[model samples]
Target: MVISPQEEPSPLLREDDRETAVQRLQEAYADERVSHEEMEERLDQVLTAKTHSELASALASLPGENPDTTSTIAAAGGRIHRGGTWRVPRILKVESAYGRVDLDLSRAVIEHPAVDIELQLGTGGAKITVPRDAIVEVEGLHTGWKDLRYKPPRRARSGGPRIRISGAMGFGRLKIRHARR
Candidate 1:
């Protein structure tokens, strides 16, 4: 057979080399780098991608960034004080291995003069210490166990910090203490 100089390669040959761009995008999403909005947008773009190059481009344009571990640790390991009823809009995530969280924020004073604390923990222990004279009112406490312990009160309202500990995997101990009366 003789080949013609004007002949061209078949376009169907390129289809076998096509990449699974949508699958790659899903993998990126599972890695927790891409936001929900970005994931949805990329998925839409990926579905409309006609060629491998176009799909690859869409994946490359995604703003997928991993979380910084140092900053997460610093945020998880600090103390905050408020003069009035303070509210921290964050769910503390402590690993099950650590099994213990010790916070010393008794110096915090609220407008009602009552220290209101709300501890929401998973499968770990929580021990919070307050000032001996500060009034303690625990709004809610959720954990994995029911081993709630409190130190003897030396002040008028320091007898015991009002608390509420409850959760699905409650298997931890909670202790409260104060030095002065």
Candidate 2:
């Protein structure tokens, strides 16, 4: 069965979700986008997904975006990172040890209403989903970095929150699913 983005929690990811996430990750492995070791490492995270958004977020990081990928993830509670170029319809000035990061969220809704505002990292990726009508605001930077990529499954649309990459590391591929509606 297809799980709705809003149904997920945070922090602690569940195991059942791992089953579904593994299937999707396998597609990336098959495409040679990710190595077998990476797949296994990511799969371990998904299986432990406590929230649906976390599971979806993990899936977003996968290499491939095949239509046939099957994912069923469960979440308990924890943190999630949103990745992409930082930009928001409204600008929120943020400063920190890592650096200043801008949030571009004029077109986002919180997949989960009970959770805190969207958190961005300075040099990592994030994956978050919201309900159909909650406006997502920039709360703060969870972490930050350069070079972010997000690729979602065929049935999904919109990438999650955007993050600014430092561009220090060589170019790499990161897939983030912003929205799936």
Candidate 3:
């Protein structure tokens, strides 16, 4: 889901988010992109950023993030729904606490032959719809309350992308199915 900058509750991110940003900045420093003084200045900006835009600008020159990078979808009590035509990253991390998740990847552009999905849900269920030719594997997932239900296609297509899902679900059930033709 895309959230406009104005619709955001608070532009300030959580402590963990700041920590991650700091780590990224440190990585950039290690890459020798800037002098020590410039790195320190950018770190200060990141640490003192008051809004999302400010923080983003602090790391705008960094050459780390890209479209194919691992993307994380997180929610704290809200729903996460993704569908339509979108670029599928190599690795996806889906996280939620009390909200449901729905991912429709039938029409998504899967560039890689293998994709990894790591789920972290608490008291919420998820429904994933994969392409008709994709192969899914959920053997590494663990559920606290209920088991997962996944229905595969009758005729599996070889050479398709492999979706590997692994994670823990608390008091929730996961349902996976292939998209209808």
- Top-lDDT candidate index: 3
> RMSD to the native, candidate 3?
10.7
Per-residue lDDT tens digits for candidate 1, residues 32-103, read: 768778888887876665543444446654444322221111223333212111111122233333345665
Better of 1 and 3 by lDDT: 3
lDDT of candidate 3 over 73-116, digit per residue (tens): 99998899876434578999999999899998764556788889
Candidate 2: 10-residue stretch with minimal lDDT: 84-93
Error (Å) of candidate 2 at residue 82 is: 24
Instruction: Estimate TM-scores for all models.
Output: 0.36, 0.30, 0.63
Q: Candidate 2 residues 1-181, lDDT tens each?
A: 0234443323344443455457657767888888878878777767665655556566554444432332222122232322221112222222122322322221222222222322223333333443222333333332233434444344533333333322221222223333333
lDDT of candidate model 2 versus the reference? 0.38
Q: For candidate 3, give the lDDT of residue 155.
A: 82
Q: What is the C-alpha RMSD of each candidate to the true structure, in Å?
A: 23.6, 16.1, 10.7
TM-score, candidate 2, is 0.30
Query: What's the TM for model 3?
Result: 0.63
lDDT of each: 0.43, 0.38, 0.76
Model 3 stretches astray by more than 4 angstroms: 1-68
